[model samples]
Target: MSTTERPRILVVGGGYVGLYAAKRIMKKMRYGEATVTVVDPRSYMTYQPFLPEVAAGSISPRHVVVPLRRVLPKAEVLTGRVTTIDQDRKVAVVTPLVGEAYELPFDYLVIALGAVSRTFPIPGLAEQGIGMKGVEEGIGLRNHVLEQLDKAESTTDENVRRKALTFVFVGGGFAGAETIGEVEDMARDAAKYYSTIKREDMRFILVDAADKILPEVGPKLGTWGKEHLESRGIEIYLNTSMDSCVDGHVVLKNGLEVDSNTIVWTAGVKPNPALARYGLPLGPRGHVDTAPTLQVQGTDYIWAAGDNAQVPDVASRKAGVENAWCPPNAQHALRQAKVLGDNVVSGMRGFPQKEYEHSNKGAVAGLGLHKGVAMIVMGKMKIKLKGRLAWYMHRGYHGMAMPTWNRKIRVFADWTLGMFLKREVVALGALETPREEFYEAAKPAPAPAAAAAPAQKAKAS
Candidate 1:
C-alpha cells in the first residue's frame, strides 16, 4: 500500500477461500512479482466443518481456527473489513477494527467474502435461536446446552423442568443433524453424573420443511439416518416447519407444540449481502457471477470463488447436466480457491487460464462417536458404508482436510486423548460474559451519602 508502483493482489474475507487462495498465489508468484494483502474482520480462518465437534466439546475452540497472520507471514494481513469497492477506479474502502476508513488501490482483487447464516423472519428467532456459523457460536452453544441441563436438574417446578429439558433443532441438513446428534450424545453421557437427570427425561425434536433428512447422501441413507436417530428416541418431524417460537413456546406447522428454552437454527446459508455494494454482476441469489476460469464476469482484474461466487460447474456440464453450478461447501471451496489463485497468477502474466472442473467425490456424515454414513463415488464405482466404519471415514476425511499440518496434528492429538480420557462436560457459561464477575467486584460501591439520604429523610419526617 505504501507504493503503487508494484502490482498488488487484495483478498477480502479470510475464510477458507481467502486463506487457501492467498497461500496458493504467494507460493506460485516469483520474488517481487506482486504483493498479496488479505483483509477480514477476524485475524483467523475457522475450519467450519469442525464446528459440530466444538459444540459437542469433542474439540477445543482454539484449535479449530488458524491464525491468518501466522499462516500468511509473507502477506499483509489486515484485521478489518472492506466496506465498499469502486471497481471502476480499482479502489476499495477499508474500515479497520479501530481506525478511520481508508481507500486501498489494488491491481487485482479476489472476492472470498463467503456466506452468512440464512434464517426466516420467524417470531422470537433473533432472541432465542442459536447458530453454528463460527467458533464463538459453537462454544456458546455448548455452554448453553449444558447450562440448560443444570436448569432442568435444579428446578423443582414441573413446568420449568420440562421446559428446560426440551430441546428443539430447526433444519435437517448436515449442521442441524450433526449438532443435534453430537449434543444428544454429550447430554446422554453427562446424565450419568447427575443424580436426578437421566437421558430418558430429556426430549429432542428436529423440525425441517424437507421430506427427508440428509438428502445430500441420497434417500436410502437419509432414511437410515432418520430411523437411526428415531431409535434413540429423537422426534423428527419431516415436512414440518416451525410456525412460531415465541416466549419459549414452539409451534410447528404439523400442530405439535412444545415449550423449550433451547432452539437452534441451522437451516441454511446465503451469500454475503455486501456483494451488492461492489457494483458487480450478481446471480439471482445475490452471489457474484463468475466464469469457469473463476474471473468475475465482464472483468479481467477481478475474481471470486467459494460461497460468494456463482461459478459454473464445468464437470457437471460436461456430464450432460445443464445450468450446473458448484455447491457451496468446504470441499468445493478449497478446490476452487487453488484454481482461482492459479488463474489470478496466469492473468497477471498473460498466460492461458485453466478452467475449474471437479466431479463429486463422495459425502460423509457423523452421527456421534461411532456412528455415521458415507458414500464414496470412484469413477463409475460407488461404495457405501455405515456404523463405526463410516464414522472413521467422517473423521479421517475431515481430519486430513483440516487447514495446516500444525492443526491436523493438534486435532488428531485431541482425538487420541479423548479415547483415553473422560469427556469434559463442565459448562463454562460465564465465558459468554467473562468480565461480568470482574465488573461486579471492581465497580465502585454506592456512596455513603447516597445510602444515608433515605434514612436521614425518614428521621426528618
Candidate 2:
C-alpha cells in the first residue's frame, strides 16, 4: 500500500473483461514490480451466456459466476463502486461496500465497467419491467415464472388466473429469446404439478422491433428460429414494439393489448454512463473510444475493453462494408482482455504492443430442452444445425467455454442429472424477502368481533 513502492494498476468493474484483464496483468507482471487492484460492486464475474439455462433450471446459479477473489488470487480485489476518477491526478474515488468513500491512487487505470440495460421513457416500464442483466435478476425471473403458476392454480377467478399465466417478453435478441424460451419450457413442465393450471392455459408473447429474432445466426437460421418458436405456441411479434406496459397492462404498437403479471425487458443495452463523468474520449454510442491496441484514446496510462469500450474490429474488410469495430460479445471480450492485459504489461516494460484481430466464429442459440440452432462459419463454408444436435452443440460449446474447471464440471453435472430427473417446478418467490411471511405470521391477531360488540352493547345499555 505504499505510495513510493510499486506501480499500481486499478481496474474498474469485475465483469468478463475486468476479471480476465486483471488476471493476465497479475500473471504477466514480474515478481513485486507492479500491483494490480480490481474494484467492482460484485465480488464475482457472471458468465452471462449461461444465464438463460440458469433461469430455465438447466444449470445452478452458483456455477455460472466466477468469484473474482478466487480467480485472481495474486491481485487485490476491492468490492466497491468507482464514483469518479480524476484522470489528471491518476486517482479514482471508490465507495466500498461497508465503509466511507476513499481515494484510490493508481499508476494506470482500466475502465471495464460494462453496459446496463437500455431503457426509454416508456410509461410504467420502470415499475413493471424485469431486467435480465445479473445473476439475481435471472433467479428472480425463474421464481417469478413459477410463482405465476402457483397463483393460477390457487385462484378461482378466471381473470386473475389468465393474467397470471400471460407472460410477455420485450426483446428478440439472445437474452430475450433465450429467457422466454427457457421460462416457457420450465412453465410447461411445471404444469404437471398443478391441478388447475395447464400448459394450454398459458400465453407466451415475444415482442421485438426488429424484423427477425436471433440475427446473429444469419437470416436463414433467424427465420428458422422464428418458425421453431411459433410452432411451439409462442406468439412471435416481429416488426413491432411495445407501446406501454404500465400497471401490468401491455399495449403493443400493432394495436394489440394484454394484461399480464410478468413483463421481462431485454430490448438492448447501452454502455454505462459512468464513463462520461471521467472525461474520457467517447464514441457516438457513449462507449469509451479506444485504439485497436485497447488503450484508451489519448492516454497511455488508461485502458478499456468489453461493452464499455469502442475498439476497432480489425478483421472485417470489404470496401463498402463497415469494418474496424468489433461487436460486444463474450468472444471478443475474452480475446480483447488477453491483448489488453498483455498490452498493459508491454507498456509497463516499454515493449511493443499488439493489435487485436479475430473473425466471428458464428453463433448458436438454444430455444428449449433438446431444441436449438447453430451456424458455425468455417472459412468459406457455413454449417447450420438444429434440433437435438444443435442443442447438444450449444450446451457443449458453453460448457467448455465456462470459466473454470470446477464450474464447467458442475454445469455438466446439472445437465447429466436433468436427463433422468424432472425439472424442479417449485417457485421460491419469497427468496428475495422470506422474512416478510415470518413477520406477518408473528403479528398479533385482531380481537374477536363478538367480544368488541358485546362490550359496546353493555356500555350503551
Candidate 3:
C-alpha cells in the first residue's frame, strides 16, 4: 500500500452491528484503500436468539457465538473497551482486558456499542437474580437450574425442597418468555430421570407488569401465547410486578408471596451508556441521535448504528409519522449495519450515501422444543402463526441469519444430533468454580494444634 494514506474506520463493539458493518465495508473497499478496526470487551459476537436453546441444552454454547477474529480476518479486531472519545482530537481511549489503556486515532468512527440488560432497583435483585445476556449467562443458568434440582432432590427439609423447585422469571418479552419455556421443558424432562422429583412438583412462574405478553406479535397471537404457556402448567401472573426478593423471599405487587431459589431477570435492554463519553448528540433515551442516513446528526466524520443509535425509521416517516424510530432488535441492527458500512465507504470515496429505510419484516420466537410463535409481515398481510409450524419457522429464520455458514452447519448438526440423543441434563456446576479444589489444596494446614500444649499440662501436674 502507501506509506500511511489508508483511512482508518474504527468500529466500537464487535457485536451484530459492528461485525456485519466491518465485513460489509471490507467487501466494498478496495485493497489498501481503508483499514477497519473493531474493538469490544468480548472477542466473540453472540447470536442472542439461540440463548434459550443453550440454556435448555438444545444446542451447545460454543455453536451460537462467532469469534470476531476468525470472522473478520481483514479487519483489525482488538479485544478491549472504548472508555472515552475526544471527538475534537479524533482519538478514543481504549481499555484492554488487562494492563494499561491507550488512545487510538481514527479518520471515521462507528459507534455500535450495543445495549445492556435493563434492570430495576428491586431489592435483593443485585445479589440474587440471574440474567441471560450472554453465552456465559446461558450456561450458568443451565448449570444453576440443574444444580437447584440436585439440591431439592438431595435435601430433606420441606422448605428447602420447595424453594429449590420454584423458579420465578420476570418480564415477558422474547427473552423472558423463550427462556422460561425452554428451561421449563428441560427441567420437566430432567425431572423424569429424578426418582424423587416430578414435573408437577416444580413451580414455573412467569410475571409481567403489563396486562399482556408478547406484544410484538399483536394481541391475538399474544393471547394464544399466554394461554399456551398456562396450559403447560406455568403460572402466568399478568399486571404483577415483583416488589422485592429479599433473601429469596419474593413479594409481588399482586399480594402474592413466595420463597424461591431462582429469580431470572429479562425485562428488556437499554442503549450502552458509553455514548455520553464520545461527545455525540444523543436522543431522549440516551441513544446516539442520527439522521435517517445513519450518520451522526451534524457529523460527517462519525456514524452510529445498532441498539445504541436512534436512527429515524424512514419507513415509518414515509407513512406520515415523524417521531418514529427503528426498534432495537437484531432485524434492524443487521440491516442498519450493512447500510452504515456502505455509507462509511461511500463517504470516504466521495460517493452518495444511502438512507436506511426498511419496515419490520416480522418476529419469530421459539417457545420450547416443539412450540413457538411467529409474525410474518408482507405488505397488508400479517400472518401470525403458533405451535410446531412456528417453531420450525423460528429455527429456519435464525439458523440462516447466524453470521457464517460454518456456524449455521454446526447449529443444524447440534439439532440433528439432539434428535437422536437425549439432552445432556447433567449440571456441571463445578465449571463455575473450576479452581475450587485447587484453592482448597493450596490453603495452609492448621498450625499442628499449637504443639498440643504438652509442656504446659506436664508442668501443671
Candidate 4:
C-alpha cells in the first residue's frame, strides 16, 4: 500500500475485462513489483449475462455481482471514473464519487471501459425506456413489470388495465428475448394468485429491427425460438422499427400501436463514448484500436480489450476474412483479459508478447424454465439443442462461467433451490422512493373523511 517506486498499473474499469485483467496481473507479478489499481464507478462488478434472471427474480442481485475489493484484495480498487487520460504525462484524471478530482500517475494503462446502452433520438426513449444492462435496471424492470400487474389488478378502467397489462420490448436480441421470456414466465405464475388478471390477459410484445433474432444461434433455431414464443401467446414483430414511444403510446413502423406502461429497450450497445476523451486511437465505432497481441496499437505500455477495444479476431483472419474483429461478448472479453494481462506482464519484463486467438465455443440462451436454445461448436461438428436440454445447457454454461468459485457456487445453489421452490414474486416498487409513504403521512391533509361529511351536511341543511 506504500506510494513508493513500484510500477503503477492503472486499470480504467473494473468490469469483466478490467477486473479479470487486474486480477491476472496481480497474480503473475511478484509482491511490490507493481502497484495495481482498478478504478470504476461501481464498487461491484455485475455479471451481465445473468441480468435477465435477476429481472425475473431467479437470482438475487447481490449474488450476481462480486464486490471489487473482496475479489481483488491485492489491487487498489477505487470507486470512481477516469474522466480523462493524459498519455503524454502518463497520468489519468480520476473523478471519485465524492471530493475533488485528482490525477493518478500510471506506468502502464489498461483501458477496459466497457460499453453503454446504444440509444437513439426516439422520442420518450430517454424517459420511458427500461434497460437490462445492470442489476439496478434488472431490479427496476422487475418492479416496473410487477407494478403494472398491480395496476391492472386494482384499476377498474379498461384503458388503464390494458395499458398496464401491455408489455412492449423493443429489440429481439439475447437481452430482449430472454427478458420477455423470463418475465412472461414470472407473470404467468403470478397471474394464478390474482383475482381478475389471468395469464392470457397480459399482452407481451417483442419488436426488433433485425430480420432474425439470436443470429448467434443461426437462422433455424432463431425461427424456432420465435415460433415457440409466439405459440406461448407472445407476439413477435420482425424487421420493424419503433417510431416513437411518447407518453407510453408505442407506435411502430408496421402500423401497430399499443399503450404500454412498460417499454424495455434492449436494442443494442455501443462502445463507451468516454474513449473519445482518452486521446487513444479509436475504431470507426468508438472502440480503442488494439493489436492481436491485445496491446493498444502503437503503444507498448498501454493495452485495451473487452467491449471497448476493437481487437482483431484471429479466427476470422484465419478464414481469409478482411477487417475481422473480436466480438464484444463475455466469452471474448474473459479470454482477452487473460491475454492482455499476460502481455502487460511480458512487456514489463521486456519479453515477447503472445497474440490473442480464440474461436467462439458457442452461445446459449434461456427462455424461462425448461425452454431454451443453444449452439455448441466442437471441432467440425455443430451441436444445436432445444427445449429442456438447451435450457439446462444454458444454465450449466453460465453457472460454471459465472466467475470465481464464490459466485459459481452461489449461482448453482440458486438453481438447485429454484427447482424445489417457486420464483419470488414480491415487487418492491417502494425502493425507488422508500420515504414517500412516510412523507405523505407527515403532510397535512386537505380534510378528513369525517370532517368533509359533516361540512357537506351543514351546507346542505
Q: After superposition, how far is residue 183 of candidate 1 from its true place, in Å?
A: 0.5
Per-residue CA lDDT of model 2 for 11-40, tens digit only, reads 999999999899899888899988889999
How well does candidate 2 score on lDDT at residue 94? 87
Candidates 1 and 4: which is better by TM-score? Answer: 1
Locate the minimum summed-lDDT window of 10 residues in model 3. Answer: 1-10
Clash counts for the predictions, in order? 0, 2, 0, 0
For residues 303-353, write the lDDT of model 3, one tens digit per residue: 899899999999988999989999988999999999999999999988888
Off by over 4 Å in 1: 1-4, 448-451, 454-461
User: Could you tell me the C-alpha RMSD of candidate 4 in Å?
Assistant: 4.3
lDDT of 3: 0.92
Error of 4 at 326 (Å): 1.1
TM-score to native of every candidate shown: 0.97, 0.95, 0.96, 0.95
- True-structure Cα RMSD, model 2: 3.1
* Superposed model 4: Cα runs more than 4 Å off: 441-461
Candidates arranged by lDDT, highest first: 1, 3, 4, 2
Work out how many backbone clashes candidate 3 has.
0
lDDT of 2 at 429: 84
